[model samples]
Target: MVTTKLEIHGRVGVIFHAILEHRHYSADQPPESLFQFIDYSNKCLETVKRSVEEYCAAKERQGFFIEQDNLSMFYETLCVGYDWNENLEDHSPTAFAESSQPPLPLPLIQQQQPQPEESEGGKPPKINLSQQRERAAKLKYKDLADYFDYPIQEAARLLNLCPTVLKKICRQEGVPRWPHRKVKSLKKQMDKVKDFMSSNVCTVEESASLQESLNKLQRDLDITVAGGKIAE
Candidate 1:
């Protein structure tokens, strides 16, 4: 199921608000009581408690638990009273994803060589394909660089920059890498969707379905898949 904001905000935030309200409700001593630090702490807790209860009650009324994206504007509404309520809205998707996929012990451990191109010591570890004017390379800014086709000092002079500064700028800007194929593919998908929407050809239902398909594709595929497609 797609993670929804309602499950995050209404369910989790409500429980959090409830527990905090309980603590504030019973806080007569130090540490538990925020009255000393915050003005109208009691009222704040009350508002939080009321907001949570109301949200839960409303959700209970509608059978909204089945869908992944639980429809609820409760978090936005609660944002008026509590400053941190906005966090639930922002972090819900990320929090849900983290909960589903536990992190690896070491991310670097999984990064094995795709296929070693250079076992020889003299050559670089990766392929140096800069000379090739492939379609993939066309998407990058190299054409502009190639237009001048001058040596470092000359190119710097043309751009009204010092050679050292130009080198630094180039280093900072960096060249497009292998995984850039994925960015190109994603951009294509985005353009397709935009074109369809702007053309006024797709019916409302078709538009919604197309949006869903695009979203699913966006979520499921990454650089590896796109790069593989590019290789094929």
Candidate 2:
């Protein structure tokens, strides 16, 4: 399962580290595979960048000043425990202390609520088809795996698709495909459902019913395979 606590922290750390390094690290390092670390870090940075841009755009649409202080605070919180060489000295003692304690169980991070539609007086946001296609192309196969009732690997095979293809499709569809370090949260699940609703894949009512069907399938599986009891 992806822990937002860890992911958010990791992303902040990577961004801070990138800023500190100025020069991007190559795919080669020592001890623990530097290439993988650099690759993952770059991906995390991209996700953060997109999120910040979106937030800024939304605020602008509302005729509000983007709160730089809040952004900085959020960045700091996410970077907690990140060993950015420069920030290492300023690491919060409290965070270190918390690290020593048995890790507290944390609830999943909820997705941010969708912003309200732009006011009638505001200019409408324009959609770029080229950018949309590029984004849609990045969806992960694993995210769509359950929709096909297959493990990620098997789903990839059945679809005759590479993981990269699945990821790209997700991006084109405007679905979040990164930092997929956890099972899809409920909000993400709904987002996927919404995507299907918008596409020619299903009608709105069919999409809703399909979601309920999937939920029922999950409940039945839990009861039969996991020995979970059905509540009245």
Question: Candidate 2's residue-wise lDDT over 135-196, tens digit each?
Answer: 53454433453543434334444443433344444444454342223333433565675667
Please give the lDDT score for candidate 1. Answer: 0.35
Q: For each candidate, what TM-score against the reference? A: 0.21, 0.18
Model 2 CA deviation exceeding 4 Å by range: 1-148, 178-232
- Tens digit of lDDT per residue, candidate 1, span 74-151? 223322233233223332232221112211110000111233334367653442222221322233233234423355
* Candidate 1: residue pairs that collide: none
Report the poorest 10 consecutive residues by lDDT, candidate 2: 30-39
Candidate 1 Cα misplacement greater than 4 A, ranges: 1-177, 220-232
Among the numbered candidates, top TM-score falls to 1
